[model samples]
Target chain A: MAALNIEQIALDIASPLAEEPGALLPILHALQEHFAYIPTEVVPGVAQLLNLSRAEVHGVISFYDWFQAEPSGASTLYICRAESCQAMGSAAVEAAAKQHLGIDYHQTSDDGRITLQPIYCLGNCACSPAVMLDEKLYSRVSAESLVAMLDNLPERES
Target chain B: MSVRVYVPSDSTALSLGADDIARGLGEIDLDIEIIRNGSRGLCWLEPLLEIDSPEGRLGFANVTAKELSTLFSDGVPGSAHPRCLGLTEELPYLKQQRRLTSARIGLMKPCSLDDYRAQGGFTGLTKALEMSCEEIVACVTDSGLRGRGGAAFPTGIKWQTVLSAEGDKKYIVCNADEGDSGTYVDRLIMECDPYTLIEGIIIASLAVNADEGYIYCRAEYPLALERLQQAIELATDAGYLKHFKLQVRKAAGAYICGEETSLLESLEGKRGQVRFRPPLPAIEGLFGKPTVVNNVISLASIPGILAGGAASYQAYGSGRSRGTLTVQLAGNIKRGGLVEVPFGLSLRQLLEDFGGGTASGRPIKAVQAGGPLGAYIPPALFDTPLDYEAFKAIGAMVGHGGLVVFDDSADLGQMARFAMEFCAVESCGKCTPCRIGSVRGVEVIDRIHQGEQVEENRILLRDLCQTMIDGSLCALGGMAPFPVLSVMEHFPDEL
Candidate 1:
């Protein structure tokens, strides 16, 4: 993928949402959806469009864990590490995940194939030990199944 | 007559490969009409395939793509297959319970407004349109409906405050940020029966006379967000939403944002920090205007109260907790799924009878009620009635009605440490007790577990928890101690 100018894309995203009340979050969402992270160069443009200070825009970005300042890896897998999953031995599953990928939570793989992150819950508590890859949620996820999935992932971001 | 088969598109069912089963069924040469419906909340029974048999809706559990071909080789509902679960309702896990808020979930096609109507969906809103705002509020108040989002505050009183509050720009906000570890009814309702929620929201708008409403759903639930957006459009195009303008707001990752005030802040595009209470949201909220903030269950229960009237809905349950509680059985349980029952059922019944014991075939040791913040009820207290007041008396909460069962293998000390760790990670960092105390808590538990200054650390942990209980701004800090204290009190040896 070609790296487009962040300013133009930010303007296009922020301009339309600027008129709406509480448009900052929506604009942030759109930007993240487009670029997979909020580019630092577009902060000023977002601030200007929303009639806010650069500090305010940056604060919002930094406050939300979902808003990444840096680009993510090829694929992201959010493993549930909350109370429910813990009861069903997510600790073991998490350990397996770390061992298999050789990466901790919030860390991307050396090959840039995956980024492991901790999610509180996926509401699939019945199945327990849930994991979300992109938009789809998988329940009762064993380390074996997860490894099989990791093995099939693309090598790097295009 | 044409044969119809129902399969759940609920994320839980999907995760268990319901899509593959559905696709395999479609590829078969049989003349079957497949309808993707919402989960019946019987999650352990997913991919719970149902076919409209002449007798009833015959059900099957754990049906795989390969099983789909063999199971349906005869091309009918009850073909004497090993997977057949007889009538769906006859299954004890699904039957022997009350379903009020989710009455129409698995029975109808999720996005079909027509199917929603056929199942008595818009009756509540229609009734609300006929009655005065005071009348609607009176009905809800009399029904004894409380917020199912852990707090258990009366829903009618909140709505009444919003109604009487003098704000020209009053708003109704649905707290769909279901961050609780074992809770998913809100997402289920929004995904399966979106119209019911839409109808309920419309009723709330009519009752409060608020022209605008927002459903602040978490970003984790993409399908729910998509379905609600579609439902809003459909309801609008159908003229059911003419009275109110409803929009869905996607919330970024923050467990604290599930708190009403924190949710308001996040909705306004700010950091999700809990606001100090004086002017409650009912009096002054949401852009400095009076707002009615309610859980998805609270709002969804409105239509039922409106349609059935207060007295009928009030008949279920015991003590102060009225109406049916949508108890989610999760974690290491065997038949884990959604079970909506009256408030007075025993935890033993839920855990043993409906849940069908542990998945690992080990004896059950502990069960965490009411999400991550709830207490760990020991086996000795399993016989306790599942009531808010009853659980409260025992130092537990029915928080969001999520019960995560743990087998004997679980380490109670590790669980205690995890509660603090979760609080440390998710704390908004606005207050001292929650922000600083949580980190200290993890260290204290670690010391206790390591037998380093065990007695002294135990005393220190008790005092620290008390300080957090009294000084913290919200439940995140206040109730984080519940699990730790309970495990310490009930299962002292483990800790």
Candidate 2:
């Protein structure tokens, strides 16, 4: 959350990775890791670095659910919407979270605390109704547990 | 010697708060060696604390932070606590299994070369190194090990094609983009026993004469990715990797990329789209080189085949569907976890014996065999034995051995809608039937569900499904209709 040198960061991440075969994904992933979002400005630079058209870069970012064009909320809440989770009553889990957060899937909360997304599966099917708070996964999650998990979040410093 | 304790580091255990258990144990003033091992695939009892004793690894199920105080009350060796499952290997769930590919999972430090070697890991590589490429291929051929990721294609034949394919630069690609709702075997291998997969890949490279290899893993699997990175470095440093250079490529989150051709496209750093076959990935794939694109299980099975001899592996299962199938039981089931059984195990027995019936304590209505694209089989056909041909006979395919159970409360009508919706959301948009037809299928299912010209919509939906099944370029478009059609067929009253 400091003032970032976007160009410098992009070049530092993209330069070495772009040398590898099929380098575009790793570069994009690294850039996303450095800064939570892929900046619109960096796409052209990445395209130039990878020797791909801007359209191609944009297309890949748009296609995969992982890459984002703008900054996401501090915490991303991914609820599994696939069949196994559905069987375990994830519909109720999704409804409760959406209601509690006052936001829908693909929407960031107004306070910029949480952004919600629907993931197909987290590969924790046996413990169904899985939810991921960013990189950490939580399984056997109920609506009550999710709301509690979401409520305990400390607000981000501006 | 200090008492050894195992706390699983696999994604499932972590999700269920295995980290907390590890932390709790850290605070305890006991002379214990806390080892972060992988899960026993006994997920229902996850956060399962195992302690080494004169008997064996004694399991403590669903251990809370508060439970740790009492855990060591009787001393270093585990006690007969109320929750203690004595002799973990002798537990009915485990004793019943015929573990092969996943034999080492949940047993040792995943990235530790020493632990892996101690457990007879590198013998496969040593054996593979001794055999010629043709001999290895022949051994696999005789084993009759089909692709575990569903297609049931003979693994030996696929390798033979790539082996003979005219290309100096052949590539070995491991498809670890496991997005299926009910499957976790791939994730387990990548996160828990990563070196096994690495060994499998190295053996594959030797068999096909490929210098470079890539594991096309999903970015969703953060732990698996991290573990794999560590495992690769450890294997490389130990010189087990030899000249075969390996790298992990994070998949751009697309369900279609789980398909081999689309995966190759994604690895090329492009939008994942279905490519037409005939030039098959075996001949011209991944930068137009002869590539052997295999599922994690398909590759992981190779080491065992080489080390144990093909006939030993082939002896387990019936017919052409030889060797053990890593059946992942999930959804509304009691005892849901990984069961590595031979091919001909009865589906009903798998559910009732291994699964111990529905967790909801309700009548089981249907089970979705395979991933999202598989058919929803009714309980009437639960007696069906698990085989490629047997499942196919019932208008189903044992795609990836993922059996997601559902109780009586589940609405087949709504699930039929979701199958199309999932397709619409994840479709690569290459073919019209998949891209356009999925959207239409969702609409038609909605219309039918709403009772808006239900009969007309039903007919229309069937026609649409037929078109998608017949005309689509890839399995994503072609097979999305399978679930819907199966639902309509089995639960006739629902839709």
Clashing pairs in 2: none
lDDT value, residue B338 of candidate 2: 96
lDDT of each: 0.89, 0.91
DockQ of every candidate structure: 0.84, 0.87
Candidate whose lDDT is highest: 2
Residue A131 error, candidate 2, Å: 0.4
Measured over the true interface residues after superposition, the C-alpha RMSD of each candidate is 0.8, 0.7
Q: lDDT (0-100) at residue B488 of candidate 1?
A: 91
lDDT of 1 by residue, B410-466 (tens): 998899999999999999999999999999999999989989999999999999999
User: Against the true structure, whose DockQ is highest?
Assistant: 2
Stretches of model 1 off by over 4 angstroms after superposition: A1-4, A154-157, B77-79
| Residue range B1-495, candidate 2, lDDT tens digits | 778999998999988778888898888888889999988899999988899988789988887777777766677545556667788999999999999999999999888888998989988989988899999889989999898877888988989999999997999999999988899999999988898898889988888899999999998899999999988988888877778899999886788899999999899999999899979999999899999988999999988889999989999986668999999999999989999999899999999999998889998999999999999999999989999999989888899989999999999989989999999999999999999999999999988888899899899999999999999998888999999999999998999
TM-scores, one per candidate: 0.98, 0.98
Docking class of 1: high
